[model samples]
Target: MERGNRIIYNQDGKIILQTGETTGDVSGHDTITELHYLDVEYGSIDYNKQHIESINPITKELVLKDIPVILTDEQKRLKALEEELSMLKEENKNRDSEIVNTAFEVVNMKLNNNI
Candidate 1:
């Protein structure tokens, strides 16, 4: 019995799964069970970040792994600035709350003196 249609690899060993292009099949191709994408919260994995770590022989699934990236100097600086901006926003929110409370207290004092 045939398991399934095996994935076709080009001369460079890259998988050819194009939409319309047709390539003749040859022998010695692996039947890929599943193709996985990197699961991360911050950003979707791009081509540069995607690395094929290994393929499970039993499962016939290609494992996708994340490649560690070192941030450039400009990237590091931008990140620092973002963090500082977040902290400043929080500080402003707290100050606004304090100002409103002080204003309420002063108004209450004036009302009591008039009473």
Candidate 2:
């Protein structure tokens, strides 16, 4: 069995979504029955949702009459930024813990006259 992808587009020539399906032999009639949209700029398909309006049998491409409202690039960037910020916050927490441990070690050394 081999996997296949169907690129779906809108009437305005903009991509809306895409779907993935696998093809099988006679005994294995497994196949993809969903639509996927192509991200022309990113050169990849968005598989987050199926937004197929129709299928163009002649061209073997899926079509959509209206594009779905998804997160814009700005929103995606913001999400990424938020994730990074969360990671940094966790890192800072670890750093703060390390600082506190170092301070404790210093205090113990001074009490033992090692400082």
Candidate 3:
């Protein structure tokens, strides 16, 4: 989420913070430029909290849990669209090849008939 922020400007003379790749130009009616992510340097404290259960008992269990990452709905939709586009492109390629082959065959047949 942190890497998804971009700066945007509005018609009302207000600056907006869009949390994604931003489109549109700074001045309206102009060509849109490719957007880039804003790099941010984060501050951090070099410290940690270390605690033991039962006043430092003979044995203790420290469980580390990691959250699972899942794809966003938009990402899923885009992936599906990409697959569909790829399939369409493949179909078009096959159709074009067939048309070319048919044309070649027709030309060859005409040449043979003339001979």
Candidate 4:
């Protein structure tokens, strides 16, 4: 989907047409520098035929296709690592709290014994 400066090309890299917002006066208003869309502009794309595809890294282009989803190896590894790190952090916090409580209990026990 495209927005802002809505310009579509026909695979040949030629401008199909501009239709969203124009840089001109509208209803005797001031000249507009840009046109804003309330939501994503599909332009000439067929929503039914095409589905959301992975965006291109180099061109930042949104590709669409009606296909199944597959997670890459790197993506899976990253997810596993994130889960492991979260668990480790929770364990560390629990251990630290335990250590602090033990120290306090030892001090209280010694004072009570002397009395």
Q: Which candidate gets the maximum lDDT versus the true structure? A: 1
lDDT against the true structure, each candidate: 0.72, 0.70, 0.59, 0.69
TM per candidate: 0.43, 0.28, 0.27, 0.29
Tell me the spans in candidate 4 whose CA falls farther than 4 Å from its real position: 1-70, 99-115
Winner on TM-score (2 vs 3): 2
Q: Which of 1 and 2 is ahead in TM-score?
A: 1
Which 10-residue window of candidate 4 scores lowest in summed lDDT?
21-30
Give the best candidate by TM-score: 1
Put down candidate 3 lDDT per residue, 8-68, tens digits, no spaces: 7776968766555445553223345743333323432222332222221233333323344
lDDT of 2 by residue, 6-112 (tens): 66687798966666666766233336586454433352335454355766766767674545668999999999999999999998998999999999999999999
Q: Residue 74 in candidate 2 has what lDDT?
A: 100
Give the per-residue lDDT of model 4 (tens digit) for 71-109: 699999999999999999998998989999999899999
Q: How does model 3 score by TM-score?
A: 0.27
How do the residues 23-65 of candidate 1 rate in per-residue lDDT, one tens digit apiece? 4563434556755543344544475888767767677665789
Looking at model 1, residue 4 earns an lDDT score of: 39
Residue 39 deviation, candidate 2, in Å? 44
Of 1 and 4, the candidate ahead on TM-score is 1
Work out candidate 1's RMSD over C-alphas: 10.7
Instruction: Score residue 4 of candidate 3 by CA lDDT.
Output: 31
Give me the displacement of residue 61 in model 4, in angstroms: 24
